[model samples]
Target: MTLPIEPTAAQQAAARVRDAVHSATVGLIEREQLAELIVLAAVAQEHLLILGPPGTAKSAVVRRVASALGGRYFEYLLGRFTEPSELFGPVDLRRLREGVVETDVSGMLPEAEVAFLDEVFLGSTAILNTLLGVLNERRFRRGHTQIECPLRVCVGAANALPDDESLAAFADRFLLHLFVEPVPDHQLEALLEGGWQSERAPLAHRTELSDIDELSRRVPLVDLTHARGLLADAIRKLRGAGLSLSDRRIVKVQRLIAAATVLAGRDTATDADLWPLFYVMPTREAQASAQDVLRDSMSAAANPTLRAAVEHAVLQPVSRAARLVEAARSCLQAGADAPGTATIAEALLREIDANFDAKSLPPELAAERARLIERVATPT
Candidate 1:
């Protein structure tokens, strides 16, 4: 397919960039799951919760990642013995005399852009409460002032998912849940051979916040029409399978796709970028739920009849809209000599977009939807 603009070196460099990032982070874990963890952490622009026993290289991996991406780093261990003041900051004494609590935002959660909170569930109420706002709203309020922490990602290291009710809300805020284990027996020799620690300098991959902001800017512009159906179908199937994840995850997955596309310097998302799900899939029990969801989806469904119904219900309108866009481009490029130039192009685009709106499938793909309706209804 021809594009209006030639694919530049940035576009050509996607795989190289991805591979470098992948290789840089791979040795820290025993399996590819950790790689997926890093990808999700990057794309979702969300924190990751690593659940495993100690000595799994959780901090090492996160530290290597921060070094590679070049984001600010803060690491702290949370335990019954942990202190809130250590993780956040010390309150200002002079301000306290003036009936004000002034705290310098310079520690683990506040000053760092990408953070590593070890033993996250063991924190006291103060830290957990502060974390709730940091993870959810991306802001930390102290005294009468709110601190907007420029967090690219936060990595929480836990021995396992917390069972306590008080911590569950904070735990749930982590969008990606990954199980990290010690290196395999075979890989241990290599681990020993390579030395016990990762050689990655924290600043090596430290991407400027502006670069991330630019990636955010580019992602929403990416067209994901082709993959949208598959993603939606996956979500519906996961729901049907009784996965315990919340609806908020659907939004997170969408954002992950967009970010992945941007990092690839692409204008649209596709199945190639779907691998990031390995990180974001909910629980160990739900890995099957995720696999089941994608098994048929990424493979192309066996139910051709149902697939056709889906295509007719979803793909046809997008196809028409794409054609309309192509036609509009041609008309506009004809230098005004083309017949009905502006009006014709506008009318076609408007109709296609109008049809695009009218073309969404029914939520319940019941018997009625299985049989194509004469006209497609617009997506709300």
Candidate 2:
């Protein structure tokens, strides 16, 4: 009998970090995507931006993830009138007496290893300008003094994307732009039933700062050559689809892909590693287009079985429509003049048409969507 092989130290460490992040995210409804991206962003040592409406649990998710990592956490809510001192700490009185302009930089964002800033787009020019260095270079500079920041990752939450051109550069600082939406109707019951139990429970598994540092060190060692050609093709497709990626973002995103590969216990990046690119688009429309481009590219690169699986998943929305169509047919047969029957059928048809427009569905699925819409609209 062959002896069982034990996981290497790196694998064990990565597993521990993954488990800790996962544990923190437990009991969150419709937040798996955001939680996963948060963990990956931390592993990449990059910043993230969460875009969604109020009460979407954006702040809660960031807090739990930061807590799981066992780091000094700082959180702030920014408004249009927010001042730099509010987030970076006030200036020292001793320095003021000497006529030196320097922030205290104690127990503030600059000193924290993990930070969450809500309504991040509302920051004024002064506040945002001061933050650029800390977010990008992990260095805080005030006056003539510059201090290294211990920030591992900074997560920003906003209800909407910045409309001002001035905030564009600041927005681009966050590599991952994840959208958080309310839980689906099916999950609402579970969400209400669970209430605050999940939020109040203490995290059982914890990842120290050292574990993350080790993972960051390992990311660069992962071979990116395997995915380089695929990445290049996908980038070209994205640009052709009218979503331009800056040179700076292009270079930085490579590190994130490699980080994901390392976390998965692989030495080489794969097509699935490009999953994060789906969220990197600047706008919601561009994000949808990028998803189509990525899905097609990943499907082409995958083996026959994997391609079939991807195709199946991509067609799931249409499948749900088909089920709806069947249900409508039954309702019509059972009660031709039933109240709300026609209304429900029309609603389903509209949803099917909307799905077809939103996604780059395959030819077969597109044809099916059209047929379903026609059938639902026509009597009998």
Candidate 3:
């Protein structure tokens, strides 16, 4: 049987790409949220730093992401002794025979479309130092020549934070940092008994690299007025929790806004799309810091849930009338005659009056209901 194709937003190319990624993978904990963040980072063409203890399936997820896109895969386990040669291709002895300064063979760093650096912070000063150039500049200098890489995204897993001062630069290069801890005690027994291990899966559908590039170009155009206020609240909460806000990271946070915008396929980003920024922050302190922010933004007072009676009897008609007017305008755009302006305006006003009358209740009850409706209508 053929799988049904899902309806997608007009500009959200990443949504389709994400579906392809979803079809190829299995066994990611909280797969829905993970998939969304993965697609957002891919859409933004930015790297992520996966922080977890061993066996958290970080590498497996990376493999799945690459499989979905049919990109070149390069994996490395960095250690204290790992040299720059392990990443950049070795010098060609044959090139020396011709007195050539550069070797034509490409290194893993240069040729990789998607790279997974496991135990990333374990590398020597040279390797960690070199990654700074590769990630930020997208180039690796070999002798007198520089090689440009066609890197789509890089996913690096860290067992623990590194102590080396130079490695800090490499750590900062990843725009998104997601920490994956083991499941809670309630889920641990099931996970162990479930016989899950990271394994390769054949691709079910593949995404074109061009689709990813197109998503990057389109994501920035999404507007985010409502989301910006909530995001500002969230960031304020983080600051209140005593997390240091770096000036450089403020710019990075804005970049993820573009990612959120593209994911929703809107010309403007909304509160619904800003949900993932809660997960993309760089530090553990920042992640722990957003709890108050979420509590305040998503609370009953801020975003109350409306009663079914009110929603159906009052809100529905008003919403329907607004949509009907929009549809009439769209019909006019299509060169089809619909209702006249005066008629449509009167119908809308009538609907509004009916809605307000139906929705009216005791003053206190009405206030509570409005609060509840506000919570439900507030974006994610």
Name the 10 consecutive residues with the lowest summed lDDT in model 3: 301-310
Q: For candidate 1, lDDT tens digit of each residue in 189-240?
A: 4455333334532222333444445555566677889768767767777678
**TM-scores of the models, in the given order?**
0.69, 0.78, 0.69
lDDT of each model, Cα atoms only? Answer: 0.57, 0.71, 0.58
In the range 290-344, model 3's lDDT, one tens digit per residue, is 5445544533211011111112112233323333343234223322132232232
Q: Highest TM-score: which candidate?
A: 2
For candidate 1, what is the lDDT?
0.57
Order by lDDT, highest first: 2, 3, 1
RMSD of each: 17.6, 10.2, 14.4
Could you tell which candidate, 1 or 2, scores higher by lDDT?
Answer: 2
Better of 2 and 3 by lDDT: 2
lDDT of 3 at 82: 84
Tens-place lDDT per residue, model 2, 128-206, is 9888989989999988568999998889989888778888778998998877678766455446543355756678688
